[model samples]
Target: MFPKSLFPIALLSIISLGSVSAVDYSETYVGCVPIGTGTSGALYSPSVYIIEDCNFACADAGYTYAYFSNPASSFCSCKNTGPAPGDISSVASGNTNCGSFQATVNALATDYSFQSCYNSPASDDTTSQSTFDSCFERCSTYTNALVAPAGTTYTCLCSNTTPSGTAESCGYDGTFFAYSHTAISSPSLVDRRRRRLERMKRDEQLRLNRFCPGGLQACIVPGSDDSFECIDTSSELESCGGCLYGSYTNSTAPAGVDCSILRGAAFGGATCANGRCEISACREGFQLVDGKCQ
Candidate 1:
């Protein structure tokens, strides 16, 4: 029998392992149909052959459609919709399939270029381009507007269909270019990835808030979310004040002054008093002035 204390660890391991499975591509096909390949939404490497791989690539690119040519020597194209303008026979049709993968579960498409067809009166409209993600996230709750303005920081509008404005190159301007997944055909695949990322973020936050294990103090390195070090703040000279505090070696005290300097041979004794460095006693012939040996 497994020990009771080991149950949580075992369960966490199971969940972690389950989240690493391949993207689900079942039920995404629209039958073997002919499609024009004149303007592909996005082109992928020729090495890809599996339909599931193409599905995921399209999802990542924030496109609703995917095209597979010559399944034997796979080539993938991602797009918003099919029936593009071109010669139908430009490519062989025996092993080609062009279709949109409707997510089986509710999922948001990220980095997609949205065209707002129309919007309700209460819908949010903003000129701040930085708020594009927030606007896109908001669209997920309502059904009317799935499309939001992209690549222009000046406006954020959502609508049911593609808006009538000129299509801007996504990520070109300093506007909200990346999109959040709102609706997709493959619910299971999109939702799974979203949930996994959310879980990882939550785990990281919890870890950051907790105390360091094994009697160690937590230290956060600048410019990193996942990098944390544990140290003994009381005795460690470098981490004298606390985590992320200035180093004692550099003469920059953490949040408080370092009393350890008074413990040297020049001073008899020192202590941290009320978050300040103080000298308890002075060495022979040395007088204490303002908590320092003079």
Candidate 2:
């Protein structure tokens, strides 16, 4: 009864509406219909016919509880909950990647002290006063964002067990930390934390080697006479170039005082006049051989 062109237009409208409905159905993550409920014995009968197909605009705007009826109706709308859309996405303010996380982490400094107890057999004891001291020093400088500096304590209870088990933790250190050694035959929590810290130190050193190589001696030695090889200069030669026990040289030797002839290969063997240390060739009449004064 309708004109040919009108029929085609009507068909197109129906098709468009169907397509829209399909898209609307895919937008919602969940949907349900409640059939009946009573005070004493409430019952919910599932009914797809009463459910609704939501729209992207509704979901995007954070409309959770929704119910649809007639042309368009939403009975329950979802609550707006979840992390802000851009907070953790590529679209975030800084758009920082995982590598950027390291920069932020390195910029921070935290300090924590814990009492470590070693109760292993006197013969198989791996705990040493020197090792603990070194580890404490390392902890003072470990600035990792993944961990906090305060509120952490660890204790190791050791026994002569062949195979080790998972470490347990107990007792709080300060106001924030508590660790227990669970397994009698396993490495204690303190030991595990120590091992983890040691691994981080090694990894950091490896990275330093890749970036600065021979100069990393300063990073490792704490204080060196030569400042050029060190990354961070803390307390005089003790924290920057070399420790009080070490020495460094960047100065060229006088004509007859060839540093290479005295210090040898063990030394970087190059003439350096800048930085904290500067020593030419061998002292007095000693010849530079290998890495020592000959």
Candidate 3:
């Protein structure tokens, strides 16, 4: 069960999940534009083979615009803004269109309000408005404003794209919001963040495994498929090898002792290794036999 106040927020998140859609290339102007030939900008790598690849690269790098030239060669370049109208060459059959990348909306709950609108390098402000509805109206004015977040009072912050470290919270005591211009409601920005979180989770799990290789006490079984457990196994006598002692039973005994000698030694000089008990030496006055002390 969840608190009634949280239901709306949960519902909004669920609704937002369904809104994600593919990128739209038509919003941009497509033409053959050579990099460094017409404008002064930094050249990227050959890894950007496709238009989407270039767009994502530019977005991740915090560039407002990206251009892919020589599709076959995958030459790409990023810039703070697209090339000038005069610099654009005739539209080529294979060249990608120059357009702003779509941004995802991120909501941040805050305890203070924004003193002023903080726009990114390529952001457009909708001025101060009284309501969220009025702020959304300004989104229509900026052709590239894909992400718009209503700020304190009537201010609206809009941007053409979002970067990896884009601020989630703007002002003190102010709630941040965002919207997309594309039909697909889900934004790539959110997707990127989600992927990053998943990677972090995987890395954390790997770290845990490295620290506790044999599995932590009773919480995990050393060699079992389902090894993870929540119960504390550190002091468990039965699971000395990180699993139930009975699980290691052999023809010689119903239960095997762990590596420690604290458990009474029923068998002569018995030692546990890899979940199995072996007799390397016998008790005093005992003579060694075929497999045990006689």
The lDDT leader among the candidates is: 1
- Between 1 and 3, whose TM-score is larger? 1
Candidate 3 Cα misplacement greater than 4 A, ranges? 1-31, 35-40, 43-46, 94-139, 142-294
Point out the worst 10-residue segment of candidate 1 by lDDT: 84-93
Off by over 4 Å in 1: 1-124, 129-132, 137-154, 162-168, 173-202, 205-215, 218-229, 232-238, 241-259, 262-294
Off by over 4 Å in 2: 1-181, 187-198, 213-258, 261-294
**Residue range 124-230, candidate 2, lDDT tens digits:** 22222222123222332222101111212122112223222321121112211111122222346446645644554454345323424354432323332223233
Instruction: Report the backbone clash tally of model 2.
Output: 44
Ranked by lDDT from best down, the candidates are 1, 3, 2
| Each candidate: RMSD | 14.9, 27.0, 20.3
On a 0 to 100 scale, what is the lDDT of residue 141 in model 2? 23
Candidate lDDT values, in order = 0.39, 0.25, 0.38
Q: Each model's TM-score, in the order given?
A: 0.32, 0.19, 0.25
Best by TM-score: 1
